[model samples]
Target: QAAERLRLSARTMHRMLRVARTIADLAGAADIATPHLSEALGYRGIALAGTRDAA
Candidate 1:
């Protein structure tokens, strides 16, 4: 659903997962949770803000 909403490619989705995993690791989480994924998406949004890709 997020991938569809963001129109993310497979590569981009994989990158997001990597970021989410890192976030989880930093939090001492054994696995990526919804919050980590949400945070990753929020960061992606922030990074894209004011850019042509921002929606």
Candidate 2:
């Protein structure tokens, strides 16, 4: 919803680290680790949300 609300492309919005940071915070992570980054990227597209979509 943030992507559409912000009028941002799914791809572009997906790459945004801001989303990752938020996810990390929600997960109570002390730092934005690789897992957090990967999880954040998952919400971007269907192709990688389940599979693998490395940036």
Candidate 3:
């Protein structure tokens, strides 16, 4: 779904999952829910955009 929606590669998908899993764990969740995924992706987008602006 992410690959279709965002044109993401397998490696990127794995990385996103890792981040989402960590986020969910930190929040005391038993699983990586959609909200966790959304938040992880949102943070990544912000960091990427910030670096571009800085450059």
Candidate 4:
């Protein structure tokens, strides 16, 4: 779902996971969740709403 929404490649998917994991760790969360993944993807140009076509 995250990958599809972001239109990212498989390798980027893995990178997003790692980044989300780190975010959770820094925030002292026991696990990665939707918001964590959301933020990570957002940094890579994936909006949560997915409505914007372009810049």
Candidate 5:
């Protein structure tokens, strides 16, 4: 996982704004926006859903 690999706490890693900024750039945006945040949140939600299903 990101925490083990990066040697950071999961909470710290999850809160990284730099990753959100990069995600926005990858989406071809000039600036980070609400859509970018929503997209990121969606991914996290999907991931959590998968984890819950497995459990």
Candidate 6:
């Protein structure tokens, strides 16, 4: 759902998941949580904001 809203590509979504996994690992979480995913997406939004493809 969030991916659809952000119009992220499959590769982008995979990157987000990797980021989320890293976040979860840093937080000592056994599994990825919503907050981790949200934070990853937030970072993605920030990264995209400076580009011509921002939406």
RMSD of each: 3.0, 8.6, 1.3, 4.7, 7.0, 2.9
| Candidate numbers, best lDDT first, in rank order | 6, 1, 3, 4, 2, 5
Clashes (backbone N, CA, C under 3 Å), per candidate, total 0, 0, 0, 0, 0, 0
lDDT of each: 0.92, 0.72, 0.89, 0.82, 0.69, 0.92
Winner of 2 and 4 under lDDT: 4
User: Which residue pairs in candidate 5 have backbone atoms (N, alpha carbon, C) closer than 3 angstroms, thus clashing?
Assistant: none
lDDT score for residue 50 of model 5: 100
Question: Candidate 4 residues 1-37, lDDT tens each?
Answer: 7578658898989988999999999999999999998
Tens-digit per-residue lDDT, 1-55, candidate 6: 9889878899999999999999999999999999999999899878878685654
Per-residue error for 46 in candidate 3, Å, reads: 1.2
Compute each candidate's TM-score over C-alphas: 0.82, 0.50, 0.83, 0.71, 0.59, 0.83
Clashing pairs in 2: none
Write one digit per residue (lDDT tens) for candidate 3, span 1-55: 7666998778877888899999999999999999999988888798889999999
Shift in Å, residue 4, candidate 5: 26
Query: Clashing residue pairs in candidate 1, if any?
Result: none
In candidate 3, stretches whose alpha carbon ends up further than 4 angstroms from where it belongs are none
Model 4, runs deviating above 4 Å: 46-55
- For residues 1-55, what per-residue lDDT tens digits would candidate 2 score against the true structure? 6567767686776576787888889989878887776676567666545566454
Ten-residue segment with the worst summed lDDT in candidate 5? Answer: 8-17
Tens digits of lDDT, candidate 5, 1-55: 5447657566745654466677889988889787776666566668779999999
Q: List the residue pairs that clash in candidate 6.
A: none
